[model samples]
Target: MTYTIGFLGTGNIAADMARALNGSGHKILVSQRNAKTAAALAAAMPEVTIAPNETVVANADILFLCLLARTAAQVLPGLPFRADQTVISVMVDMPLARLRSLCAPATDIVLTIPLPPIAQGGCPLPVFPDCPALHRLFGDRNLILPQPSETALNAHLAASAICATLLDQMMTTADWLAAFTGDDDAAQAYVAAMIRGYLSDRPRPGALPAALRGLSTEGGLNATLRAAMAPAKDSLRNGLDGFRPRLGLPLGPEP
Candidate 1:
């Protein structure tokens, strides 16, 4: 059965989700806050259209909320929300409890983390302990990881913020390689494919240790590079652990 999916914000994640869902039979209604993005998405997808936030709330069967947590407090309470429509927040740092209060009377509230690659399928999608609505929407498209608690979801939230930085790091290396190869495209393709293949073949249960052991042969180039990069990796991990506070999330060691 087709559902009407309304997006309250047209930020990165929302845009990507709309892009991925394009051509699907579901009706996709989007809020007009980020007018440029909403218009572009509507123009690109037949099932998608731009609408006022209240209209989106009233018309949609499901709402994918991407508003900033800081502003959500000021914005959501003003709009009338239905008890029957499911509200799935893709915003970071905003707890389910707060969302419940703001979107009260609308009990089917859930939390979700969607990566850009979800449109292409095969990425890991994280949702709350008992949110079946999320699984129904994203389960077949990606690996569904049903986190046991909000804390667990937050841990994933911190970790999820690193994908772009990881890409940037890869691009830095690729740029250096471009200098040698005299072709940025070839260097990027090679680096991207190499890194992607490494990621694809990562060991299931004990990825970090298995990756270290598998890649670092004695006196090998991989071993040497790993040693040189240890500090940077540590910084990245530390930075991720502390990033939630910047997003206004309650920060404690991941439970």
Candidate 2:
């Protein structure tokens, strides 16, 4: 079945989703709040339509709120919706209860988070998969995940810090290797391959720690670097510890 999906915001995240849905046999209705983005999307995908925000909400069967947390509060209160309309929220760090309160009386409200890689059909979308609409949208790429309590979700938000932190470290390592070898392209290629291999080949849950444990093989060169990096890893733990209290969760015992 072709679903008519309404996008309440046309930001980068929304655009990425639109690109994925383009020519996928889904009807897309885009909001006019971001006129340039909406027009661009409509131009790129002939099936997408540029409509006023209110009209888009009224016409489409499924509504996706892709706005920032602060903006969502202001926009949701003023928007039009029906009791039968299905709603999905993509805003990070916003609790499910808050979303339910804001969008109550809808047919169903789903809380979800997708990484930016959805455009390339590579995102491991974590969502409350109870809703059929979410199931259809995610297709086979989704990880069927239960919505953790708000506290757990907050912790996972901190977990996202690891991605940027690791990527930056990889980039620096690539640059350092380039300096030593005087071959920039080769250095980047090598680092890229290492990252892809590590991610693709690793086992789940204990994979990262297992890789680190392997580095400690009866005291080797990698073991020395692992010892040196202990302080940096501790700093990361401390940073996440500090964030817990800010979100009203107990700091607990620091790692």
Tens-digit lDDT string for candidate 2 (1-255): 888999988988888888878677888998886888888998889989988888878877889888898988887775677788888878875667777777766647776666667776756555563567877876655454555555655565667667788888888999999999999889989998977876642238988777767667766887877787889988988887878875546667643
Note the Cα lDDT for every prediction shown.
Answer: 0.83, 0.76
Q: How close is candidate 1 to the true structure, as a TM-score?
A: 0.90
Q: How much is the lDDT of residue 159 in candidate 1? A: 82
Question: After superposing candidate 2, which stretches have Cα over 4 Å from the reference?
Answer: 201-206, 245-250, 253-255
Q: lDDT tens string, model 1, 70-126? A: 888888997879999999998886888999999978989888888888767777877
